[model samples]
Target: MKAMLEGLEYAPEDNAAATTAATAETVGYAFSSDHLRALERDGYVVVDDLISQDVARAAAASARAMYDRGVMQNLRQEGRDDDVAVLATSSLPAGDEFAGLRPCVEALLRVPDDLRRVVARVDDDALGADVVSKVRACRAPDRLMLARYGSESCRYVPHLDNDPSDDANDAGSPGLRPSDRVFTLIAYLNPDWDATRGGRFRAYRPGVAADAASPSDFVDIDPILGRVVVFDAAKLLHEVRPSFHDRYAVTVWTRGAELLPA
Candidate 1:
């Protein structure tokens, strides 16, 4: 959506059609019947093992290493900037610490194809077809970030990500007008996390007025390794509980609009 990839300009020169084809060929993952039902009913779904345990572990390790190296800069939320930060993908080059996780990034790029399928299944024929076409026409996001939440003070408040129109993002950047973003995908990287860790992810019902402190009327997801959570970025109000243990996640967004002129 936002051409500014986490504060750095990155426009991949790959052929769009070819990239889409490749994505379709490689992404064998899909939401189960139960998960699909949950998504339609609750606006979110937690799909375990979206990627292999090995891949998730490797990615988490790589991301944590980057965080330790000070590659991530503070994220600028409207009220707080210390809770989160963008993991500078620019600092990661091939054959570096993040090299092992490249396949995970590519897999994430194919997520829109899965979303198109979900749209087809849940929406009416006309609307589903239109949404599918729009998703197909959208370009994959070039920027990937290791969004890290601090163990002590950092906690993401409940908020919607983006809508079709536009809104400011967590990074305190201008929103993506005619917004292409569709879903929010967060792949948990906490290898041996538990409820005691207190970094649980929660998704609320649509139109709820709850914030981080009052999250009783919601679904809580554990930040365990290899768990990928997908949700309607524009519709769901979600937040992360303050963690006792550090949390790491590979966060990316899926687009649903036609590509815009550069």
Candidate 2:
């Protein structure tokens, strides 16, 4: 279990650590204080080479195998009329499509260890140290999922993932924080990538203007191998540009708990 992270420079705190316990294994990528501040203000931060090249390759290989088996479920944009995007789909860990993805999913869930540390810095008295544990126990399905973008036409338009009106939200459940998906972690497993290849992930600045129809300013991040993007989905707006090449990655959402009744 060696990490192959060369040619990538990061702060001392940016280095990742992993440990296996008797019951569960814990692997976390540490974010510097500066990075935490950026996330607090900008709503997103891209951590370079958070995992070893071998680990990323393994996740990608497993994902590709599952895709070849035709086990993943196709997902389309809420209002789109285009045909199903085989590459633009997700596979849940507990489902049949996840038979070969267990190890990768397990590694992904461990990311919460680092995420909890970051969240603890935000209003610690309010969120508390157990926020991550409580979130893991919530009724919401917070399973690890594989999101693949394989087609040139497959694109995700600018939108919030937790918008109540969206049919893909919490199965239309009505309750406190029905759309309270607190954070999102996307670990890129692609081997080779470039901006010209498309499938760039973009994050917009907050408070653009309520009257404005769309966000104007944003930062685009290339989905390079071993790069992990963490963002607060409840506050930031983002989307995936149409991808010309097949892309594979593991995505997980941290569900926020409701403190009071709706």
Question: Highest TM-score among the candidates is held by which one?
Answer: 1
Q: Score each candidate by Cα lDDT.
A: 0.63, 0.57
**TM-score to native of every candidate shown:** 0.75, 0.67
Please give the TM-score that candidate 2 achieves against the real structure.
0.67
- What tens-digit string does per-residue lDDT give for candidate 1 at 174-255? 2232244566778888888988888788788766767433545787899899898987667787878778888888877665
lDDT of 2: 0.57
Off by over 4 Å in 2: 1-29, 79-103, 118-142, 165-178, 209-216, 257-262
Identify the leading candidate in terms of lDDT. Answer: 1
Clashing pairs in model 2, backbone N/Cα/C closer than 3 A: 87-148
lDDT of the structure predicted as candidate 1: 0.63
